[model samples]
Target chain A: MDVALDTLKFIDLTTANIIFLFIVGFIGGLVSGFIGSGGAFVLTPGMMSLGVPGTVAVASNMCHKFPKALVGAIKRFRYGQVDIKLGLVMAASAGVGVQVGIKLQNFILDKWGQSGSNLYVSLSFVAVLVIVGGYVFYDAMTADKSGKPEAVAPLALRLQKIELWPMMTFKTAGVRISMWFTVPVGFATGMLAATIAVGGFIGVPGMIYVIGASGLVASATELVIAFAMGLGGTINWAMHGMVDIRLTVIILAGSLLGVQLGAIGTTIVKESLIKFVMGSIMLIVAVSRALAVPKYLAELGLLDVAPGTVAIMDKASFLIMCGALLMGAVIILGSMYKARKAHARQEQEAFGQA
Target chain B: MAHEMTKKQAVVRMIGFGAASAAVFGGIFLFANPLTEIFSRGGMYAALPIATVFLVSYVHGGFASNLWTALGITAKQPAKTLRPTATKRPEVRATLNA
Candidate 1:
């Protein structure tokens, strides 16, 4: 599955590639700005489909991502959704987590070669998506059932009580907890990100459930963590001459627009909707990753699946991946539309009052 | 209210972003061979991507921001009803003491 850089011949940007890049970039940015961890999931595969090598795809994606994340963080900051103190603390710990994650990744790569590495990544993706996404979905549903938004988990409340050393306060996130608690959660998110490319799966929930940040702040803060991780990851991959600038530029062009729109959409919606959207994307993405696992297992000879079965699984995986993005876009757009209508109604009411 | 950008501000942002993006593209196009040669130099190759990431973040990031504002998409003010409170929750006292 690993496409070697030496074998990759640079191709001129075709019109299709250009158009696709812009569209995906916008959508990916929208998802990222909304959920804080979706652009890479789409952009990496999107570029790979265009004859870009895997490393180049990853590198280019990272190259585009940092700036996008930076812009997103700034925009969200203006809306007062970002908790800089908390974001910086988590980001610092996550940096170390990335180093450990890379070492583990290299170890897997050395032991199983490319297929094994792919299997490891895919399995981790499925596992994290299932557990985290499932919990989020279940929580969202139960909250809806109760006719009240889901409260922070009991586990997070207990964790917050420990009063460990170097206690920090995030006023915006409305949490005052020890730095010790945040480190492990941030580290795990980074580790998962190193493996799966979507750290927000862990990062957002970790902040919400573990650190007790509201969904809005948690999602916005993830951008800060993402920027740090992407900056580091880009440098690492670029050194190997793996970054394709054309790919980076193309994706950036679209994501910027999408991210800004996403950030603005947040202001119009209720806080709970953020959780709803995040949980939805996480669950569907879990399904998408789960679909890919059988194919990986088949490659490892762990399962004696048929060729057509493998083909179906591969298609299913890609479809589900696209489904995750589509589902996210639907939620954001639908919520934005509803909010706009409500806003218009309020404006009319105010005019009547005047 | 969405602040309408004056023509001068719009022109300045556009030119700044345009020049940076062009320089990046030009650097890649004209110096492809030399850049690749230096970047693939193993240990030092790390700097190339790092530098480029920063460069792209500044240029492309700026372009994206300005482009969005130019199109009238901007962050909205916080809803008045959702204001934060400085008072600690009473639940914190019981839980923290325990």
Candidate 2:
């Protein structure tokens, strides 16, 4: 398909655009750092709104994502929240999963063209975010009301009991699950990542509810998967000249800092809150993507929507995406600040006693 | 409680790490346009962008890590690690810091 010339043009950088991207990158980084996967769902769409083509926006955002994930993974590793073996195992399979994902995307793009492709991506986003996000939100609520640690899912417990060959134990994540169980999660994660830039939507939840890892370990371990997927995705995108390096670098400037702060945040808060934040953001982002559905439907000639309505919905969707990022930031920062004060109080009391 | 070292020493380390971070960030932006053009040219050139992200991650990521330590925002994991079950994570019942 001859991608139109206008679709790939690198827009002249305006100061306003740069500042906007930096802010988004920072918030996206924050969420990613704290939960181990996110940011790209907003960043990709954020870039496209600024006159970048859809593919370039996706590619450039991806280019920045791996590095940020790497930084977050390293920080979380220091906290012993990382399962290096589990991460590597997941990553290896996710690599293959990504290729399959990309192939599926290309197939859709070839047959359906851009508008159809957009619809497919949007539908996928809505379906996954609503279903998975709803499950996570319910779990968070249950855990919150009880004010206790989450019980391992019955499903994960059963899976662990299977005497499948190549059963593996992840010391950090503290689970002993068969590779058969782990592979699908990794594969699904990669596929979602390729479909939408938010693989953690599946990756993190899959770890918690399916594999029975603690929220802290599950989230931190996600960085490993993100790093692997991001690296592979970026290379594939860059190979096709899809990456706009300027966007990648500019976003990284803010994201690197955001990611580090986020990683530190994981240490200070209760594990359940991670699920809360993840669940809330996922639901909100689903709405954001859902808002765009009508626009795509109009384009596909499947709906009788007016042009003005489509335009309005598109803008609305973008704003909501920004809102999702903002909400995630607010939750993370608020938790961190509270944790710091309590820690300070404890320290001062200890000093007085001494 | 990131004050493992004296404030003065921490200040020096912060400045040192801060400068290194700035230098690397500056270096990337310095060649930003041309480098982007070359890296995005496609084909085998894909490796360049991947490697570049890796380098930037290490340099910038390390700097950010240090920046946090210098600012005294380190994680307090050892306290929680003593608990046998992860389900026993401390109840952070405090509301948002007003």
Cα lDDT of candidate 1 equals: 0.76
Q: Give stretches of model 1 more than 4 Å off.
A: A1-9, A110-113, A142-152, B1-63, B66-72, B79-98
lDDT of 2 by residue, B1-98 (tens): 23355546656776776787678668766776677777878999998888877777776666666677778877766224511322222345868878
- Give each candidate's interface RMSD in Å: 6.2, 6.8
lDDT of 1 at A78: 76
lDDT of 1 at A77: 84
TM-score of 2: 0.89
Q: How would you encode candidate 2's per-residue C-alpha lDDT over A180-224 as one tens digit per residue?
A: 999998888888877886788998999888888878888889999
Go through the candidates in order and give each one's DockQ. Answer: 0.27, 0.23
**How big is the positional error of residue A327 in model 1, measured in Å on the Cα after superposition?**
2.0
Evaluate residue A50 in candidate 1 and report its C-alpha lDDT on the 0 to 100 scale.
74
